[model samples]
Structures are given as C-alpha cells and as structure tokens.
Target: MADGETIARERIERLESLAREAVAADEEDRARSYVRRARRVAERHRLRLPRSFERSTCDACDTYLRYGYNARSRTQSGHVVVTCDCGAQSRYPYE
Candidate 1:
C-alpha cells in the first residue's frame, strides 16, 4: 500500500475509536461527526471502510449505531436486519 493509503487508514481508525467513545458518552452529534469524517477520508483515498465499521454506521445519516441504544437489530429471512433511529434499515445475509 502507498503512504497515503496507510495514513488514511490510520486516520480512519482514530476517527472510529473517537466515534465509539463519543457514542458511549451519549454525544450523538460528536459521534456522527466522526463517522462522517472517517467516510470522507475513505472516499478521498479510494479505500473501502472495514466491514464492521460500515455495518455499525447508518448510511443515510452518518450516525454511529449502537444496537439496542440508537438502533434495533433482528434476524429475518436468513438476513440480519439493522434499523437505525432515523428509520433506515440495512440487511446483511447470514450463514
């Protein structure tokens, strides 16, 4: 990987950690900001966000999702369904 890619990855990691901390502290807006920034860095670097991070974020509102807190999760039709507080739903297939 290039130096830029390495840097972007580091930044994304940092942002993700900060976002988690913010969410744990009940600062939704701050966590959302971190999520948005991480996405922007990934886009600018043409890098894919990690799968876990992607699934833990709301695509519509860029908010960090905490299952049972700001989001709801259920299994249906062989897929895991995640629903955000903003009424957005994401489904991922399960084995």
Candidate 2:
C-alpha cells in the first residue's frame, strides 16, 4: 500500500497536470483552484512543491501561469521576471 507521503505526492502530480489542462482549456478559475489544492496537499504532507510546479505558479495569487495568457515574462539583467495578471511578480535567474 502506498504511504501517506506517496499518496500526497501522487495527488500533487495529478493536480499539477489538471492545472495545466485547465490552463490549456482557458479555465483560469479552475486552474487557480487546482494550484491551491496542490499547495494544500503539499502543506498537509509536510512536503515542498516540485521546482517546476513552484515556478509555474504565482506565489501570491496561487494562479497557474502560462507564458502569454495570464502571465507576462521579461528578461532583465541576469533574471527572468514573470508577472501574473494579479500583479504578482516572481524572478528566476537565468544562466
């Protein structure tokens, strides 16, 4: 039987994929709900979100981010800045 940690991980992965599908389907509210659900699962399991998952979501608004849709990307200096529609900004450094 799968342990709680494994179950939580699976749920997180499922939620991530669902969020992507929701975004692709242009269901912004659904995508946001999925993101929030995944976050809750991770918190309950005492786990950190996957790096890709973390970067693909808005920390402030819990919105799943797509490059052109609800998100804008800009390169400044050595970092890539992603701005969500909610005006939340996150920076990732590029090599």
Candidate 3:
C-alpha cells in the first residue's frame, strides 16, 4: 500500500482503540470524541464504518443524539440514558 494509505489505516486503528478504551473507562465524552475522529478518518479513506455514521435518534421525540463536542453538557447519571439538547432521551446498553 501507499504511504498515505498506510498512515490512514494506522491512524484509524489507533482512533478505534482509543474509542474502545474510552467506552470501557465509562468516559462517554472521550469515547464520542474518538468515535467521531475515527469516522472522519474512514470518510477520508472512502471506507465504511461498521455502525451507522449518523447520530442516533430518540424514537419518541425524534431528537438527534449528539456526540463529541456537539453533545449536551449535562453529566450522565446512574444509567446510560443519553439525552439530546432537544430534550429527547434514549437509553444505551453500554454495560
């Protein structure tokens, strides 16, 4: 492979590893950041990510769940119910 492709692959792998670590550490903010970075890398390479690249949505109210810098600043509580700035909430089975 070309040097650029190799570098992109390496960067994507590192970002994915970081994302997994952030999730395991229960650092939702950090995890979301890494996930976004990874997605960007994938897009740059014209590659497809395993999961949907779009933000998740709340079924009831149809609020788009934001991640990374776009996510709401509210601290998560006991469970993994993520809420968007639009006041829509949905639970995630992280644990």
Candidate 4:
C-alpha cells in the first residue's frame, strides 16, 4: 500500500476506536462527530463507506460489510478485492 493509504487507514482506525468509546460512555453527540469524521476518511480513500443508517449486505460476497477492511463488493469473478488500501483495483465501479 502507498503511504497515503496506510496513513488514512490508521487514522480511520483511531477514529473508530474513539467512536466506540464515546458510544460506550453514552456520549451520542461526540460519537456522531467521530462517525462523521470516519465517514469522511473512508470517502477520501474511495472506500465507499456503508451508510450510517442502512443495513445493506455486500452485493458480491454476502458478508456483513464492516468498517475499514470490512466494506467492499466483489466482482462476478470472485476476487477478494480490499476496496480500501489494496493499491491494486479490479472490480471497482469504473472498471
């Protein structure tokens, strides 16, 4: 992975961790902010962050798309493409 991707992923992870903590503490407002930031990070990296309110399944693998490495769609050919920071893309919308 490229330096940018690595850094972005790490930052997203931190944000997620913090978000979880905020939720556990019942700090809904702060948790929402963290979630917004996390969503921004995911968008910046073109990871197609799942909707905050949508309970959608992966269109390909049928796995529950989690945040970070958990969100992605596979091609019809069955490739485990990590849409976040893999640096090599195959089944993206453009291709």
TM-scores for every candidate against the unseen true structure: 0.98, 0.93, 0.49, 0.50
Candidate 2 weakest lDDT stretch, 10 residues: 1-10
Better of 1 and 3 by lDDT: 1
Q: Which stretches of candidate 1 lie over 4 Å from their true place?
A: none
Best-to-worst order by lDDT is 1, 2, 3, 4
1-95: candidate 2 lDDT, tens digit per residue: 34999999999999999999999999989999999999999998899999999999999989899999889999999999999999999999999
What digit string (tens of lDDT, one per residue) describes model 3 on residues 1-95? 78877787788677766765665666767766776776678779876554432335333433234465334533356446556655666554443
lDDT, candidate 1, at 67: 93
Highest lDDT against the true fold, candidate: 1
Per-model lDDT = 0.97, 0.95, 0.57, 0.54
Our tally of clashes for model 1 stands at: 0
Winner of 1 and 3 under TM-score: 1
Task: Provide the lowest-lDDT 10-residue window in model 3.
Answer: 55-64
Query: How well is each residue in 1-95 modelled by candidate 4, as lDDT tens digits?
Result: 88888887778777766766775676656766776776678789976554432232233322323445444555554544544233333343333
Q: Is candidate 1 or candidate 4 better by lDDT?
A: 1
| Model 3 vs. true fold: TM | 0.49
RMSD of each: 0.5, 1.7, 9.2, 11.1
